[model samples]
Target: MPETTYSSDASGQGTNGSRFNRIAMALFGRQRDKLQDPFYLLLLLGFISQGFFWENTVVPIMLAALWFLLIHLSSRKYAINETTEILFLLLALLISIHFGRTAFMRSLSFGNGLLVLQAMRMLRPLTPREKCLSAGIAIVNIAVGSQMMLEYGFILVLAAALVLILQTFHKLEAESCGFHESKFSPRAKWKEFSFVVLAMIIFFLVFPRYRALSSVTTNLSIGRNAPIAPTLDPASGGMEGTGRLIFQISGDDIGYLKTFTLDTFDGTRWAAGKHASAFKRNLRVEPKPELKYRKAIVKEIALLGGSLPADGYPVALKGNFFQDDYVSWQGSIRVSRYWPADNNIYEYWTDLNKHLDADSRETASCLKHPELSDRAKKMIADTTAAAAGEYNKARALEKHLRDTFTYELGTYDLNRLNPLDDFLFNEKRGHCERFASALVLLFRQMGIPSRIAIGFVPVEKNEIGGFFNIRDTHAHAWVEAYLPDRGWLVFDATPVSDRVLQRPASGFALTMRDWVEFIWYQKIVGFTSNDQVMLYKFTAEGIDVAAEKVSRNSGIMILLTILLLALTGGIVIFRRYSAGKAGRSSSITYSEIFAEHFYRDLLRELASAGIRRVPSETPGEILRRASIKIPSAASEITFITDEFCKIRYGGRKPEEDLHDKVKSSLHAVKSAIKSRKTFATDLH
Candidate 1:
């Protein structure tokens, strides 16, 4: 026996961190990957999916990952206590209360709270049965998170989760069958997933979307959540925000969607005015014409803060949402209550034609601080001096600002007593905010009713879906001046000079992303029972149309069909024939292998008795040699050799007597040798 010594290079990663990592991996890492790796990844993905609507997702995902790591790395001596269950109960209660109190926070408080609970359950060690239960919990977490918000993100997350979930079960099945270190093939994975995906697609097509459990495509765009209100403050925000799609507009009324008008200037920023109707101010509500002069625009939009923008006169705006939940305030639409999460495809007769009534003239004219700097007041008066009436005066002021002021997105001083004065007098370069603010103030001084309107101006229409993809960069501010003779007229004072124009947002990557989102929204999230019926109809109609077309060209179609069938039959026959040919050759069966094992053992036993057989020696030669070396055991050797030859080369099958015959022959040989030794010792 020798004591072996082993040494390797030290230093580098082989230090404490590496040592700990090695120890950790040896003790607690993937153990041949029996579903734990995929399960853990699935857990994290389930939490991450909620990030679309839930703000508290990152913390839960972090907590789950940290706790998972610690639990696996340690000995995991702990178990789930009654206290843990009680904590989960208390959390659920609090979440229910929060949901009741803040109804719109469905995805935020409740969805994230459930995920955190699932994460906390992983604090203890998990047995096989417990692991199965944990998998069920993960499913719940995924379902909870997914149902709260259905977006393109959730679709992606669910796709990944599906793969992981299927892998986890596959591993479990392998482990059950004693194949602990099962090697999963990527090809097999896709093959298995195809069946599941096909099943899911069929289910989605067949199942009617129940109103009680319908999901919503939430407004998760950062562009949608940006601070949209006007603030004349020196905010250090980016010049242009992210290019994420806020929403999309598909119709001809694809111009500016007025959200709200900034009525009063608190000097630093313009505050949104109270919700008031055109009728409240003694204004006539324009009826929707029987024939829309401008073609009807149907829009599918998702926005935050209950703001669903409708264009033009808001008298005849029709949508799939509750009429009671929405209100047309000052030509803008606002969802007064929680969204119904029901059918929608909102239609607007919006022509981008804005009009204000005589009743709003006085309200729009009033301002908080009309006293501008002396220079600004003088310049504005001189600019409008040639204007005859209110309409001319307002146009004159708008033209003056649009012509003279340079459009630049620059931060303005919030604390300045008069930002309008700064823009007009010192720095004439400003964005639409400044230009629109300057015009509004000048109109107020001239005894004209004007207010700043902040909304979006869509410029690029998607070439794929033919919809206007609105991003935060499309946000604009302009002025709406009231005229007693005509109506409220639109005016934008932001000059087009020196502004960076964006290239058409059309590329392979962008087109694909938009296309995926469009499908998710239109075909997936917004899918209804009606949609299901329509899908069936569409499928049936498509088949019928295709069949009709083929019938019209029956001669060519029959020839093509026959060729296709022959080709398919030939391919199938070829594959089967190839498989059969490959399988024809074979090896020894289990019984033959057993017989060979016995023959080899017989030779080894004789060699151990000091009658070693040469590798080249045949079984018969070896048996004879062994008998000659010990002549007393000649008959016993003869019987054993005959039996082995019969089975090994004579094509005899193993039988019940095979074991007994070999055992008895070997015993008889050993007895003969012992008897011979005794007799020879006596004679000596």
Candidate 2:
């Protein structure tokens, strides 16, 4: 207070501190210069890739265009202003509304809303926080994809996405450290990252999983414009002849892919009553009927209908989300919920040749139908008149329809009062639906329990994959008649010539793609908890069998062990003999000779002094400790020990003259130890 004088030194120090603070801020503080980093583009591409799995094409296309524009803007260093932000926000709002409206109009589901949000987030320049958000969204997208489609291609994509995401974080850390170069090489970083991915896979496999209760009820409508339940409505328009792929079937033999069977014919449309309940109840309580089963794997490539398609008489099904959605009864399965459009893999154990004795209730349900027209009644009576038993009667009706009717598409009488009657009497040339409907009604009227089954007939087997590639064009209807002793036997009244038409052969590339997809579905996607248990049991049984065999051949095993030990000893002795011969030659180094002789001489001296070196203790360590008891020869002991250590561990090649010096040092130490032992004996 008295002087109040500022020093030039203090002022200079203050100025320097302010400059350092500014530099630190420039390095570590949040950057506001760039709109977004180039690494974020990898995240954008990953997000865009997931859209291909969805049915929405417009959203993905728009998002892709927007992303390209953003990348262009970022490359040109175009800064986003308030106007740009507002425009992007408005565009996002419009897209959301359009998506919501389209989803509502078409009755389509809006799955995890991340895809839309990711697209919107990509529109603006991202800060560090926003980049982190984008990375998280990309990770979630990969996780969602794994659940939807567990293909090997998808797994590869997921791995790439993870690497890109990690690289982005690594770049962020570099930027924070004020370094333009990466801390680690890309190859090195990825090698370390591979372990992390391996750990994640291990956790996924070993962690216990529980089925989450699904809250969303899928619309069980057959198709976009089709009925809720499968109907044999001959009044409906002709079959969809599009050759678009619907599903794939992998098994030994292909057959009719049966979904639902309709029993009640209400004069116009054939419908199943309480079909969902019937299937669920039958599967829950009933023992799988005594029938031989052939296992098949089915994968939905495109959405065909609401219910899951399978061969007739599915004994069991393996899938992910819709395990409880389906019910099985009377050689048919009815799904209560709609299937996802992509990667819905299911394994079916079906009785391809089902033989069952139907209960009274099932027989009655199949026989019950609406009032039949006199024309229909007369036709049924005539067809089954000459036939003896129910089986023969069903076969007779099936043969009559096949022989009399000709297959024609888009020839249905929509306005007719009785579609089946029109098909049988007037229009003898109709699709499989008409023929199947006629045969089913005829069997019912003849006191034979029968139902019409609606599903695809997998006739086109891929030569490369050895599996059937079912298409929408293959959607067919057939009859299943209940006999006296045997169960419901599949009776397709559709003409064999029409049903057995040759399908267009698949190209090599397409066939190979299908083969890869089939392997993925069978080995990876189809592996369930039951399969895991089976694998565990199989491994344990193998171990037990191996142990039992070893025990049974105990004498042989002991002889083998002895022979192995003898061979190993002989090899060691041969190596030592070879080394000895090499040493006897003048080519042996001085260090090697000194190291061997010095170690053996030191051990012998220590033993004479009644202080033998233990096996666990090294020569150098023993000499150092022994020096305390025999201090007079400490210097010589230290020199010899150092020489041995250099030769043995340090790989040092001493001069030939140094070998003589080491020998002299060992001699002095041995004489000192012998003199000490003699003095001790004289005192005793």
Candidate 3:
């Protein structure tokens, strides 16, 4: 007997040839002695964690040490190739270098080190275990890399690289076994993968996204301004040369447009200054006073992807307004240093001057106080108190403004040092901003506590939602006068003809895409989890939370969750079942079993004629039952027919192994019948 070098057990196939044994012996190489698993484990840990621990050099250095150990261990399995050599050098460079310009860049460098480790493992002669470890490292790298902002181009390249690695390792495995058969052909498999991706997209879109599952708030600093203090030179000349207008405001209330609050005036240009004594985190403006016969003008304001221009005080504002989440307030709205532009929506109704009456004088007076600005105090004192001649003087001043000053956009320029002073005296032709500024200043001159209110007018009617489409062109400004009992009344001086608030005909200002996006944000993406739950309940059983939660604990919520889970489970089970059934072979019918039994007996009766057939075959399968020689055998062949009748038509259970017995008898009958017929023919 040949000497068997390799032994095989019941568990798996064994190689016995001397040459095969030599190949298997190559697995335990000398390099394996120096390698350690901790290096790989550390890499995995760095990939999973975040923050200061990972951001600082501690985690990264630990990961590098781990990589060194794993490489040392891998030496025992496979010899290092040129690729692995380069990877070793790259690791040294990465660990020694520091790239701290950005968090994203730092993460990229760290991820690169992990990739190098994996690539080196793949280049060296790797066993199955080594291959698995490298693959796992690659997976961890991908998982960590997902947290970084990888560009679209890089994502495609990474996907291709992973596929190539998988295919290469699979080929290597097959080559080692001397077998090269692919489990699935590439052509059909890609189509299946595409369908899977499509199904995933559908699932994401339909799944109920629970918002409360994560308490971490999304810190979107897109529009937040940097906290760095800007440098200003007092002697650097006031205006930096006027250029083309950046924005334009036109409306019945577009008077005295204030684009910014500059309280930090350092003797030259007004800058961001300290907050007012009463400034609060979230200031709510008081609604204007309502009076009988007051003319009502609805103003629509838009923030054309820029900052809000207001005096550091807005006590109350109402409209469909969405402030950037990152917008902070050092007493007022502070645009993010990073992202400085955003669009905003504003709309509201204010009590017109027509609401004012003689009896409301005391109410208006009560609203005014002495600690107010000189301009406002003067304006109020001149307008109110009919006992003095100041009331007539205020009326005369108001009439002059209503009859004079032509309305136009861009009447003021960057060259104008005092925009308010220029509009009132030099430039008789001014826009809404100029008109409103003049009115407020005049009221202040009369000793009345009045402030300029900026807004817009003639709000656009959105064709899709029947809501208002307020835009930058609707930016407007007006005067708010405090009344004793009426609070504040909004008064506009700009003529209505100058206003431009409706959608423009050019189609450039308000495009269809913008409208669609607005609808998407307002309806779908903005729907909170609470909204989803309410909607689900409304669709399912017409229940609302307020009516039930106050009453008692309702098991309906629990039952609904369970029912949903069961429905999901049932779908999964049915899909798996259907998939299994699709792979099955030819099905059996009840009639086919009976036919097999009937044919088996006929073949058994022909046994003496040297004819034979299997019991599982049909009647049409037998053709050699013509050589039977005995007369008794011919009678026996007739008996086989009776047996077939009982089993096929009687519906009674056959005897144990009855089909085998019937097949034998049928073969004997065939030989007997054939022998008698063939002998008789020969004699003739």
Please give the lDDT score for candidate 2: 0.63
lDDT of each: 0.60, 0.63, 0.42
Candidates arranged by TM-score, highest first: 2, 1, 3
Per-residue C-alpha lDDT of model 2 across residues 1-684, encoded as one tens digit per residue: 132432224234323456654443344232211224436656555556555434345655665666555544443344556565456555644654555433332222222355555555555556555666777766765554344344466676666766677677776645433334245566767786987789876664555233222234465545544322356676665654667666676665556677667777777887765642365432333225353333345444225454566665566665643535455455555555543423455555666665666777777788776677898888878888999988887888889888877877677465567676667777788777777777877777778888888777777777776777776677778888877788768898888744454466778898898788766665455555655665677889999998999899999989999999999999999999988887666434655766877777877777778778776655545765778889999898777776666555444566668767877887898889888988989999
Give the local distance difference test score of model 3.
0.42
Q: State the RMSD for candidate 1.
A: 14.8
Quick one: best TM-score, which candidate?
2
TM-score of 1: 0.51
TM-score-wise, the better of 1 and 3 is: 1
Give each model a TM-score. Answer: 0.51, 0.52, 0.39
Once fitted onto the true fold, the runs of candidate 3 whose alpha carbons sit more than 4 angstroms away are: 1-97, 102-109, 121-259, 262-331, 335-406, 410-428, 452-684
Q: Across residues 528-579, which tens digit of lDDT does each residue of candidate 1 receive?
A: 5545755777899999999999989999999999999999999999998876
